[model samples]
Target chain A: MRNILLTISYLGTRYHGFQVQKNAVTVAQTLQDAMEILLGRREDIKGCSRTDAGVHAGFYCLNFKTENPMPLPRIQRGLNGLLPWDISVRGCREVPEDFHARYDVLGKRYRYLIWNSPARSPFWEGRAYSYYPPLDLEKARAVCRAYVGSHDFSAFCSVKSDVEDRVRTVTHCGIEREGDLVTFTVEGDGFLYHMVRIMVGTMFWVNEGRLSVEEIPAIIASRDRGRAGKTAPACGLYLDRVFYDLEGLRWEEGKDLG
Target chain B: MADLENIEHLRKKRARIGFLKKALALLLIVAAIALAVAFRHEISRLNLVEQLTSHLVGIGSGPGWPVDISGITVREMAPMGNDLAVLTDTDLIFYSAQGREIRRVQHGCANPVMKVGGTRVLLYDTGSREIRVESKTRTVGSKTMEYAVDTGDISANNCVVLVTQGARYASEVTVLDKNLAQLYQWRSADSRVMVAALSDQQDEMAVGTVNVRDGQLYSTLLLFRFDEEQEYVREELAGELIHSLRYKQGCLQALSSRRLLTFSETGKRMAEYSLGEETLTAFDSGAELFTTLLVGDYREFKELDLAIVDYTGAAVGGSQLDFQVEDSTAAGDRVVLQSGGTLYLYGGGALLDEMAPLMEILDIQLVGKNLYLLTPSTLEKITVR
Candidate 1:
């Protein structure tokens, strides 16, 4: 059997998200069905991660095993052609039988957009939240900086999230603005559900003069979701990319010599 | 000769066995590496889910280095540019193409207000009656000679149009140059001007007046000469209760509560159509497109539609955009909309695309592009390409 990795992108607006559900349409179910049709067999496919409903992915990864020996390019093309317009496969590569897409991911990055305007936008009607009130970018930045380093981010996550470990490392966080648009970009080893949104919500308090940037340490120490800003809407957030170690995939002299 | 042949055969057999062993070893190594990779990915995924759940449950610090700002609000977001301009409601803050702070203008305004015009930054202070024009190389500031009027608003043409209604009770539309100098002021025969809009060229102004006896608002799109006398030469359109009006290119677009109307600059009615049952929530006009957003019922939040109108007052394309409120508590969160080549969506107080439960979209803005969205945030700096 051959294992293959697939890189994909999809619009998350309609489906239940990236994972498959028993009765709901999902990106995974759709891709699995398409693959089943192309391969003429029921193949169990796995996704890199499960994105919640309304969550979008720019670069997502998945893998499936098959006994067929078709070329990698054909698999990528055939699956893309059969999938819906909103879902697209960018590339595919054959891997050793043991390789897995979700299990091999090293880290992920996400971005959040804020439209701070006084008038509601007709174009961005369903895409962004209209924050009419003013914000303090400096305070937001300071709070963002506090999110860096390895810590238990229990304070910034949503309730009802069932995970074993709360500890994660945030590699980077920053706030930026142009004209009337502000954005927050964060990268980390991993994230909690609604972590980015709640962090943003807490930062809003600082930006809006309600919370102090210095208080972030206390908030982190508390590990309370109620202390953070409202969980931001789902539309404005995007999974930007995922990273993996590139040791054996590409030519390495040490491995080659060994 | 027989002994030599036997030795050669033995050597060949040994060589073949060695090659096979090497191949098997290589295969094992590859398998191990693949397994390791797969294991790492699985562990990370589990760790991520656990970390996410724990964080959501308020146990650990979330992802990234925590950044603390006074406050952060997405002021304006452009999907095509993947860039957002945010303001802290204080001074001028400019972000680079890579989401970095490039420049900031301190003490730029006591109360900074911005009107977007084809990538131009027309900033004004109602309190000080001051105007500042910002571009790439030059930052110019000017003050109006007259006192700041109560009902003054800037037009797409960068003209400040005002209607003063106290004491004198006279209707006036003053055309100001970029320097805030009174180029000309056109006074109406009657004193009750209801609404006004400036032509895209800044050469003309349209005014609406209410006829009390008929209990209806009568609007006339007037042509004015800014250079010479500033006199109204002709009346463009007379309509009842002009609810909204916008001037783009050479055409004057107006909307009553019940119908959509278009007029030419030469005082001629171009076209008129009924708006039907959908209540117009917002309207915007660009050089190439006129957009209108309509909402049905709040409880049902029933039908949300975006109608794109051409210059000739014809509906070229229309589509229904859906938004879910989830429940009653999700109400009151402002939905932000923006348009350039395509429409962008945001709700729940954060910019869209950050937590997109849908597809990944890049938000971008070109230098000198005019982006219009509704928020209460102050306007930051405008980047000139």
Candidate 2:
């Protein structure tokens, strides 16, 4: 059996989240089911991260051992055929036996979409969140700039979440607005549960004039969830991409890809 | 003399002790005051009385819901029991009551649209020319269209109707089953096929066409059946553009922008009503009743009105909304009109209640007995009264 790496995209609207839990359905389980049906055997899938439910992903990574020597084209088409319409496997490749989808990760990018229009479209029904009140875009951006660089994101994550360390390096966290669509993109080495959502929710509070941008340092120092804004909806959050040192996003018709 | 000497010695000792004690007390007091000033912020943090009072001043509660999933690019939603079928740009997701996705399928479709028909779902991708028929969690069957289909709809009885047009001259109509297999096909040889409607049983179909007679354009509706191979009824609608050809509640409704004409299933003219000469923006329907939002200039008058019209082409009741509605959805016995951040829920054509203002609401949908509010960040569920 050969270990394989797959790039994936999914609409999180119907998922319990990216990770599998008891009783609840997940994206990973769905992919595993499709893999089993395609290869006619069970394949243990290891996902890069445990994205919460309703969080979309433009690019995510996972690995599985496939005894079936299905070619790249066949695997892509076959798994896609067996999979549901909401989840898609973009590409697949054979990686080194020791290559891991999670451990060797260099960074990951996440994005959240905000519909700033007062009027919402039925087309955007489940896709983007609508923010009606006029927000201070300039100040909201300033708050985003403050999050750039490495820091302890203790207060930015779920208080109930117990991680050994809350220290994460945020290489980029910025906000951009095009018409009424507001996008928040962040690049980091790792994230805590609900960290991105809380960052966004708190940024909104800053824009709403409820919280000051200067209070962010104290909130981080406080390491308290109460100091941050509301956790933004999972619908607006998306796993944008995962980066490895060399593999990046290239998985062409090559002999080996990791 | 010895007593006097002892008294003097005692006085000297007492004076020296007093001076030393005073200096020590002053130094200690100064040190204590310096420490308090230096750690004032830290001391304030320990003030439990202030902390409780500050908690009281804090607004309601904060948002930290451990929500599982969020929705996106939702093209359409079909509420099923405690679940919802959401059609995104390229996929179909079936979500449980708690917003957990039970199943998902990637259609790789372009310009996708989904409709819930009876117990089956019809997912069509106009760009890919593909139609996938899904029942619950499984895709039962799928087929590809030869041409890019424009207007298509499915019935609860598992009938699919599609209108494909290459140009104004090249047009065709096809009817299919839940498997997306073509059961009936018709290509317009003389007139351009504008729109088509399928019956609930998948046994009957209606096609609307536009043909020229003596240089005058004429609109017509024809009834057909596969076994009969005959045009049961060919009703000519003069000068009226049949915008929508739908069979609702045992009647054929051919509605244009300004008029609605009803016909019997057997192709007999029943009744007709002239809507105000205005642009009909949106039309929402229930099991038996339908209403249209007419904006822009209405005849000579200009305002927004919700005209409730029945299948017999008669106006049930017309009410002018008090506010400019951004969007609205009506289902069962409830009609919700959203203006800005507030929602006005109406029952029996009268205002019932108003939802509190939200930060931003993109859309509001009535699912079963619950209210689904689409915000900028989440889809919140609220109980219906």
List model 2 lDDT by residue over A91-180, tens digit each: 888888887888867777788889888898677666777777766778888888788777888888775677878899887777888888
Candidate 1 lDDT by residue in tens digits, A47-123? 87878777777778788988988788888889888999989998788776777777877777777777888987777
lDDT of candidates 1 onward, in order: 0.60, 0.72
The residue-by-residue lDDT of candidate 2 on B162-271, one tens digit each, is 87875544677888865566788777767777778777646788888887888767887788876676678887876666677777776777776557778776778888
* lDDT minimum window of 10 residues, candidate 1 chain A: A249-258
Candidate 2 CAPRI assessment class: incorrect
DockQ of 2: 0.01
Error of 2 at B103 (Å): 2.5
TM-scores of all candidate predictions against the true structure: 0.39, 0.46
lDDT for position A64 in model 1:
90
Q: What is candidate 2's TM-score against the reference?
A: 0.46
